[model samples]
Target: MSLFRREDLHSLAAPYALDALEPPERVRFEKHLKGCDRCAAEVRALSEDAVRLAWSAATPAPAALRDRVMAAVRTTPQDPAPQDTARAPARARATQLPPHVWGTQPPPRQRERRRIPLFVPFATATAAAALVVASLFAVQANRTQDELTAERDRSREIAHVLAAPDARASSGRDGRGRTIGVIASATEGSAVVTLGGYGDPSGGRVHQLWLMRPGAQPRSLGLFESDTPLVATGLGTSATSLAVTVEPAGGSPQPTTQPIVQLALKSVGFGE
Candidate 1:
């Protein structure tokens, strides 16, 4: 049948389980339930939910409730449906009503019991959507973890180089007279530099660091985001100059402005 018709059948599961559907609608849905595994499962679950809700609201009935009900029954005649021929006694109504209501006897339209396996397309679609969301979250978490790990590894390496027994460290004033500090490994070009009192950059500008050897051209380390210390690996061990210049926010191929502070090393020192 059409998809809309199938969805309609699924929609009735809750009302059907609660005995809220009209007799004819109930009969139609029961037929749908026999072949539609999803509807049957849903109806069964809804029925259980209803039972739990009912029990949660349960309390001891008033002691005189049965007597009061009987008195009301004795004085009041039951109203009958206009379509029903004659009202059956309460006990006989069980057999007289259609199977859709009482469900004690087989209805003429469907007598043979048929087994249908449970497979719900809607439930499958929901599960797939959940899996996709979960996969996305897992991938994001892994990427965040990797970024944190890389930062920690960088910090450790910087600490090791600065703590070396043979690591040479020096502090002096730049042309700006702002304090500049340097600690370079004796065996390698591994180094850490600290800068302070160099105010913030103007809009569209960033501070860049560079290393210059005796006769070689100055090499760019990278852009600095903060006045905090920075670590540079694989620098020239013979470098005698360190400089910071204001450049485009992303930095430049060469210095775009005069150095904010330039420290010319007396010696690229420490025992080598």
Candidate 2:
């Protein structure tokens, strides 16, 4: 019975292309490759990736490391020659042989057989290294993709708010003349806050946003560090304006400092 199933054979293409399979497995996979177009194509693709990855990651070996390896190679002792079994006395050979002239029996002290060594071609070694680096690249690419997806979703929400029929914008400047603007959409019940030239919040603090009302505790919108635009949702009709205050890092549950910048939302009929 075959040790590998049909589906199992396909998985060997990468290792085979990389010359990482054992001799027996290699022979079986080679037989499968002859009849499997999909496996053949995959092998070709993996081989190509291996080649490209090798060239991209190749670096000259350090002189010190190379010198050390060469020194070890030169100083290493060669293995002693194998014993001459034929030189053994005739009396010993007869005892080790089968009793009958034509019989097949085990010898008393047969030489130990050595396993065929695994040989990795230079190209395949490059492929193995490439596989390691490729895994790392794949992880980074996935993280970058996730970031792009998040940014895209945020942009869509901001666009939705800006395109509302009742959308209106309010702008004001801080004591330092850094501009802060809010576009509130009554229909969408959300606001997009934009900042310009609003350098670091400074003094180990973060810029916090609040929704202020006549007779209510200020509602926290979120925290800001840079000039990145933020979208604040749940803009109820009672909120009169948006305010910015500098608070300790990580921000506070409530406003700790007086407002440095405020943009009245009345223009968008938010408090009405």
TM-score of 2: 0.45
Give all TM-scores, in the order shown: 0.42, 0.45
Q: Worst 10-residue stretch by lDDT in candidate 1?
A: 110-119
**What is the C-alpha local distance difference test score of each model?**
0.56, 0.61
Candidate 1 lDDT tens digits, 3-67: 34878888988887778987777778765766665565566667767778879998888979989
Residue-level lDDT of model 2, residues 1-272, one tens digit each, is: 77999989989877866667888887777657556656765776676666776699889989999999999989875432222122122222222211221122122332322100111222343333222211111112123545555544555566567667777777786543357777778878898886654555767898888989899999999986355567899888888988988889998999999987888998877888
Candidate whose lDDT is highest:
2
Query: Candidate 1 at residue 175, lDDT?
Result: 44
